[model samples]
Target: MDVVLVSRTQAKLDATADEIRAQYPSRRVKCVRADFTDPDTSAVYSHVGRELHGLEVGVLVNNVGLSYPHPEYFLKAAEDRCGDADGGKAAASAGWGPQLFDDMVRCNITSMVNMCRLVMPGMADRKRGCVINIGSTASRIPCPLLTMYGATKKFVEKFSRELNTEYGGKGKHGTNITVQCVMPGYVATKMSKIARTSWLVPSPDTFVKSALQTTGLEPVTTGYFPHTLMVKAIELAESISESMMARTVMNNMLGIRARALRRLAKEQQQREEAQSATATDK
Candidate 1:
């Protein structure tokens, strides 16, 4: 079995490759460093074709994603980080300007679609392949502060479901291509900012292991058992009253946003003090 690890960080990729090599000495582990945020990511497809040559990719994991530095309202995030969405005003004049949103679109949506485009045809021809897309439980509900992220993940959920229906089967004309959308609630990963693994939040390896168990069983899942439970609870709550659920989630997000802003303010103050102290010493 040949495994290809693609990421923006070379050191991390190398470390992962080493770990995989250690686990399966006979299996080949390859690492490709590519920034999917860039338009140049299209080039990586060409590289894959050249490097893998006649070999078929039996599994493809579309796991690359990007979220906000911290949760905030869509308008606030758009204006503060991606320039003026309202108008070319001073309040939003000095920021990332549409570029951040563009990058997110590329990373979350375009990259996944492009990867499926690159590998799905071959899988169809071979009549065997598995595509696992990492979605989020955020997609299942209406999250105000995490609007854009949730929307993109919803896209993944819908896309994966349709793709599986379109290609997954063992019939005479079946493509035999399996597409699974794994929606995780929370995992103890850098992205989740959860340092400790708890009943609710599992480690990435544990999450993946659990998710893999349901690959051919379900086209869409919460992946981890605990996460599935969490999702079910949320679904139950939503079933009772979606408005109440939305209001409850909105209140929770508002609190998180408040705390994040406070933390940022504190950090900025600390930085300013450090600068002042340095100037005084100078």
Candidate 2:
């Protein structure tokens, strides 16, 4: 199948395209550089739509997403304000105020909605297509420090389910379009900051292979067996004591947050020392 790859980095896209071409010499691979984090959602998707105008896109994978640099409380995450000229008053009034939060909404939520809008109509006209939305296990339960990220993923889950029902069969449009949401657990990727692959945390290649197999079979799945087990464990914990489970999750996220902050501080100190050494040499 001909593939269209879109992401923020052109170099990475080119590299991925090369890999695909090496694997399947006959298949055509097109790369489009687009940043989903851009606040101007219309322009971003419009460009994407133009690039894909003639292509019969059989499958659209809404894989682009953004998460917290480190797990943090909703309000606390917005502490930096990210150059809010209003002295953060506007963000404060909105309850949670972070440029990062707005970015996450655009990247995680808006990208999916807009891409579907662009691709689904053609799929309906042809009467066939598949949409794969990557969600997260965090959406299944209450995530305290990772609240906004989880909420955005929850939106993905609900949207995929409802959209699937609308077009997966003979519906209003009389089309068969499958919208599947794959809610995966930890994977060894740059986004997850997971360097090593474990049984519980598969590599991107491994996770994608497994998830691809479940395309039309399952509407909502963890994709990997280990991830499914992880979700089941979370379900068990919720059933036993939701409050306890929440506290456990909060404590885990707090530990992660503390370590991330410590790492950031250390890196900053190292940078300062390097600058000082350079100044001394001068």
**Candidate number achieving the greatest lDDT relative to the actual structure:** 2
Cα shift from native, residue 130, model 2 (Å): 0.8
- Give the whole-model CA lDDT for all candidates, comma-separated: 0.81, 0.86
Judge candidate 1 against the unseen true structure and give its global Cα lDDT, from 0 to 1: 0.81
For every candidate structure, what is the RMSD over all alpha carbons to the true structure, in angstroms?
A: 3.7, 4.6
Q: How far in Å is the alpha carbon of 45 misplaced in model 1?
A: 4.3
Cα shift from native, residue 244, model 1 (Å): 1.5
Candidate 1 local lDDT, 1-282, one digit each (tens): 789888889999999999999999999887878788886765866765565556689999999998876666676776543322322232232323456677778889888998898788889988899999999998996678878889899999999999999999998767999999999998998988889998898888888888889999999999888777778898899999999999999999888766655665666567779989999999
Count backbone overlaps in model 1.
Answer: 0
Candidate 2 residues 1-282, lDDT tens each?
999999999999999999999999999999998999888887898899999998899999999988887776676778664213322232222223468788889989999999999999999999999999999988896778888899999999999999998899866765899999999999999989999999999999999999999999999998999989888988998999999998898898888876766666566567779989999999
**Count of residue pairs whose backbone atoms collide, per candidate:** 0, 0
- Once fitted onto the true fold, the runs of candidate 1 whose alpha carbons sit more than 4 angstroms away are 40-53, 80-97
Q: Model 2, residue 1: displacement in angstroms?
A: 0.7
